[model samples]
Target: MTLDALKIPETPVCAAALEVAVAYCSPALLNHSVRAYIWAAAYGEAQGIAFDPELLYVGSMFHDIALMPEFDNHTAGFDVASGHVAWVFGAGAGWPVTRRRRLVEVVISHMLDSVDVAADPEGHLLERSTSMDISGRHMDDFSAPFKAEVLRRYPRLGIAEEFLACFRDQAVRKPDSSPAASLRDNIAERILANQLDRTG
Candidate 1:
């Protein structure tokens, strides 16, 4: 299925966020960001979850932005820094303070091991979807047909190597951060072994 087949949000905010991602993210990273949203929305539909598409779409776009050199932070974790960036983006998009904070929460929460879907459906979906895209975690949650179409439309483009390099660098610089913890937990192996890497 195409992205349009998934009914992706086409609001001004969604369009603007895509622009920002395209401007800053490498081609591989840009496709990964878009795939992140596609995965989340597809999973949400299959599960019958009611989530704010705009929040999830924008959060997915900015969730890994700190992986870029210009956005990387010296002290805070990449997820934390990315959260702040999304907050700023939300403000510029004319979102209220509460909504902006929710955006920040969704972006940062994607790094967590798990998020309560009832409390924050967008965060829950994003976390699960990023994990699905990166390490094939919870791959069974999506049907084989859906997974095939998503991969066909937005190929991984060797994100296995690209993302591992990003995380390895992050681990070196932010020894006390989440990426460091992930490396310690053998995330590199997981990324390399991801089932998606073997597909189209």
Candidate 2:
């Protein structure tokens, strides 16, 4: 969906904040933001979650803006930058302090696998869920807590079964790769599959 189609608060402050975020991000990365925002918004909607598309869009666009060349790692960059984007965007939008803080927390906490997996198993599960969601698969081995948390956070996104199935198919398709690469390939395949299906 286009930014105009989103139901964000259309204040000047919000617009400026979005501009700042887009300015800080690279064009290619910004493209990723578009796709990510679409996925996130759709997932949230499907699960009956109430998310600000503008927040998801701007937040995700600049989530990795803080990345330094030394830390070319996607996970690490996302972890650090998500926090910064939340802060900057929240402040720029003049959001209520409490709401801003919550937004920051959400952004900082969004990148699940990028953080400590042992300490934040929930985050890991979220990462896995997102992967499965993107791949349009179902994951049979997902823990109850993980499933519950996902459903809780995204009540509008009721595609858990489909996501799990896609997740399992992706794993079977690429059994030997690292989880990150596997997730990437899963997303790529899903995109290709969508295109083929649409055209066919």
- Which candidate's lDDT is highest? 1
Report lDDT (Cα) of residue 190, candidate 2: 63
Model 1's alpha-carbon lDDT is: 0.91
Q: Which prediction has the highest TM-score against the true structure?
A: 1
lDDT of 1 by residue, 1-200 (tens): 44567887889999999999999998889989999999899889889999999999999999999999999999888899999999999999999999999999999999899999999999999999999899889979776777888888888888889999989888898899999999999988889999988765
How many steric clashes between backbone atoms does each model show?
A: 0, 22
What is the lDDT for 82 in model 1? 96
The lDDT values for all models are: 0.91, 0.46
lDDT against true structure, model 2: 0.46
For model 2, state the Cα shift of residue 68 in Å. 6.0
lDDT of 2 at 8: 48
